[model samples]
Target chain A: MNTLRRSVSLIALVAVAACSKKQPPAPAPAPAPAPAPRVNQDSIDRANAAKAAAAAEAERQRLAAATAAEASRLDAARTAARAKLGMVIYFDYDKDEIREDQRVTLDAKVPILNANPDVKMRIAGHTDDRGSDEYNLALGQRRAAAVRRYMAARGVADGRFEVVSFGEQRPASPGESEDAWAKNRRAEFEITGGGTALKVP
Target chain B: MIKSARLLCVCCVCGLLSGLTPAQTRAQDTAVASGVRIGLTYDRHGKPGIAITPVSGPNADSVRAILIRDFDFSDRITVIAPDSGEPPTGALNYPLYAKLLATTVVQAVVTPAGALHVAVHDVAQKRVALVLDIALPTPAYSGDWRAVVHAAADSIEWIVTGQKGIAGTRVMYARNSGRSTQLWTVDSDGANARPVAGTENAMSPDWHPSGKKIVYDLLPDDGRHRIVVRDLTGATPTWSTGAASLNFSPVFTPDGSKVVFAAGNDATDLYEASPGSADPPRRLTSRKGSSNSSPTFSPDGRRIAFTSGLLGHPEVYITDADGSSSELLTASGFGDRLFRSNPAWSPDNRLVAFQSRINDVFQVMTISVRDNSTRQWTSDGANEDPSWAPDGRHLVFVSTRTGTKELWVLDLDTSRARQLTHGGRVQNPAWSPRLELSRQP
Candidate 1:
């Protein structure tokens, strides 16, 4: 009986020891800075690279803005030059000949010719849709010629100006009213050659 | 004496050669120049009274005079003076008569209806080769006389060229007015223009094989676009497409039985509609995420070439009429940087002509189907929207190089282009098919 009690006591002691759940000893503390060295270097390099990219992007945007500003300025200058060189001479209805009222416009256009002596211009004369195309074209030419003659009288060389007839080919605005016809019957100046290049070829 | 007489004979022969009468040779030249012979209308006195009134007014006299003086001008009939009760005797005698002096007689008259009537008579045939009438409102001043006379001359041009005159035809174009883009049609000479439809953002315009119907895209109040066919023959159009969605670039099959137009929102594809029916459109292209538009039918209706925006940007594509076996025709990768659009099939169906933006100017260019070679036809202006003349030897396009867009005709063979419309900005020309039956030869 004594032997049996001793063996059971020993088995119980072994089970208690297994159930105690003793933990393994913690690993020796690592050397102070080894764990995170590569991560820190990686983060620092990434931060530096991002800062450089941001600076480059900002610089690019500044350059783009400058380019855009320059383009806008050039466009404005061209528009101004075009306005100065252009002339719209009005005519009477069904007739492409210059009317007395249009002489004032012609007088104003003389300064442009004096300023741009070498500028070759095309005077496209137009008419309302009141007649056949061929008739309108011939009428338009006469109107352009009338402008040309006036320009010549104003001291512009004849060779600097060419005449084209758009007779009923384009309209300022579309309508059958007298207002439209009056607008359509006019000569417009187009700068064909020798003007400062507004946009490059 | 014999040697002197021989020398005199030689001198006489040389003198005869030198003294060939200038007036007599001029008469012979005139006879040769006027290439027609005419039988005159017999009168009671046997004198043909052909009266020519002065239609030349304003600046036309100078232009007409220039044309006549510079160009070869001939007459088929010689006018003789009238007898005493009328001015001269022997005016009716044929002994003094000569052969015809002109090929065609150009008659100019201001008709009773206030229209200018110009008739070209082939004197030998004694029949009118061409007659052109131009309607001009009575002038505020004396008369629109110069325009009328010039118009008459232009009408006679049809007789000389053997092509239908552009005087009576119309031009269709797109314009922006008061913040709205609309499709409009005007007289070929740029008169009587009004909005057909699409008062807001209209794009391509396809005329039915029948000149009566014009189909174009009309933007809806909701912002989506739909194709609408308007019959311009009536004062008000009859809308054929009852439903509205994102429909665009509609073209009729060669037979005009069905229309193939682009439909849908993101997945745009071609659809054909049967006449007078609201049947659901059958989808043609099957590729998902692919958008196809601007479908133009071949002359035989066997194939259609369209622009596809499937892979990034737009490219020209051709497919069978039933929408199968698709292939890409234009490869833009190699130095060809032009932006090509508006493919118009040639009248012969062997070539496709299109407008391309090159060096900031749009010009008409054509590609041959057999060799896939392309050639540019125009370079003078901001030319675009080329429509082939029915004869296939000419193309009419729009140009803005004059600082305004206008219709211009380019002769294919001559490589010469002339402006057609002057005062109005015209574009999107769809040339009519040759009339099935022209006025008999």
Candidate 2:
């Protein structure tokens, strides 16, 4: 009986050793859960920091592009204003009618005048030095009236425009050539009021 | 009328002198306060020859030169130089003057006290026609000497032709002096030229019938063209078309009571305004869509001649004083239908002179009111803005014949044109009436 009891005790000790090795697998699951929570928290903090930095960088780039676009738009508006102000409409000899080619120049003025409602403009008619001064004065007045009528038809108010006739007294180019006379027979526009707001390029 | 009276007085003087002895006649001529009178008749067959002896004293050469030039410019007389051996000073040499085929002889001498003595001899009448003595303020005043000579020449012209010469008168014109165009007045002989208007853009000056006022278009610095009636007696603006757009081509009525001008912004029309009226001007024309301008009244102030574009182009039109019964004076057959402007009525009440465009060039033309017959006086270079002299036998106009616009005077009888102003484009000549009131010694 004593020898049988001693052999059982040795078997029990072997089982105990095998159980201890199995116990390690169960604790490993518990510690694995704690370490997993810690690793997940650390990873979450790094991901959140990276996401905020990326969003800030994208916002900065967007603001830079928008500012560049606005500057370009203002520059273009100023250039167009300058061109519109300098535009002149030519007329035929001894005629006050507006030609088809001159419509384009007149059309460009409509938008500018409409955009600035408070602006007052002067439409001056000029003629070449060919006819009598008194007669030329009448012709120039007709030309200026024609221009005013055209602009009025295109929604420009009459109150904003003042028509004047320079007749043969003022010549754009002082000469007797056809080219110079053609230049002299023209309608010129001047912004008499509300011109301070126009940005110069 | 003054000439006929002077002629009668001269005949009486001749009758009285013929009854006296030669020595007694000389003593009576020196004692008579009236000038010596001799019956002088002009040769009708051709231009009469007048001999002028060489003058002596201070500024005598200049005076003689001026007299010769003025006589030549008269276009009514021919000057005959004395023979090489002829005496510079002498008594009546009627036979010798007749031998030279001269109807009249002029002798001038200056005394040591700076007094000018002029004598006119009638070759046919065999006597001195007239004698004039002028005292000079200073012997060194050459201008005064010229003036005295001009006055004598005028007197001689009146005695010969029954019409006063324009040598003592002045012509006002618009002179473009580089920076600005101003109104200037020059002696009829183109001497003593000076600006009458201030330094501003002025044009189309017209003289008052009284010769004491001027009406012109003044372009002020404010850019508004105004018709200003300026008084020469005071050198102040009597009236102005304030803020009127396109007011121009103003002329005083023949009676000098009203001013007719072209005024409008869209359709120009003639309007009459008083010199000092505060009321708005009276519209003289009612034509719509047609421009009427350059108004001039008849000598009687019963009719007005103006330029109108009613027929698609400018043409001269005449209307009653109230702008009624309009008649087209210029026909298509007279000139191109492009332009006719600057109408000036003659004092004789027979002709209306204007500038008409012919073949793209402007020329001076006249249309008789009775016959409607048109006659062109200028064909070379653009001639325009005709103004009749007081005598109605001559006209002052602007011409571009010398490649620059200048003032010129045309004699109707001789059809001769003489340049009056040189340099710097000039235009719009206005001949004044007899300026006896304004003549300065």
Each model's backbone clash number = 18, 0
For B1-441, candidate 2 gives per-residue lDDT tens digits of 012222321210000000111111122112211111112333433767778777777656555555655666666667775424443554666786787678888787777877777777788998877776766434332333444556667777766666667665668888764335688876666654566735268888888877778889886533467889877745468788744567888898888999989887667888989988897999888888887888888889999999998887788999998888899998767544478887889988999999988887789999998888989999889898898887788899888888888889898987877778867478778888765422233
Per-residue alpha-carbon lDDT of model 1 for B330-431, expressed as tens digits? 655323543465677777787787766677456678887667888888777677767765556667777776767777767666575665555554545665
TM-score to native of every candidate shown:
0.47, 0.78
Write down the lDDT that model 2 would get: 0.73
Q: Among all windows of ten consecutive residues in candidate 1 chain A, which has the lowest summed lDDT?
A: A130-139
Report the lDDT tens digits of candidate 2 across residue range A95-116. Answer: 8899789999988888877777
Which segments of model 2 are wrong by more than 4 Å?
A: A1-83, A198-201, B1-45, B83-87, B111-115, B135-148, B177-179, B197-199, B233-235, B335-337, B437-441
Q: Which candidate is the best by TM-score?
A: 2
lDDT of residue B408 for candidate 2 = 90
Task: List the candidate 1 regions with Cα displacement exceeding 4 Å.
Answer: A1-201, B1-102, B113-119, B123-166, B197-203, B233-237, B240-245, B331-338, B420-427, B432-441
Index of the highest-lDDT prediction: 2
TM-scores of the candidates, chain A only:
0.56, 0.63
**Model 2 residue B216 CA deviation in Å:** 0.7
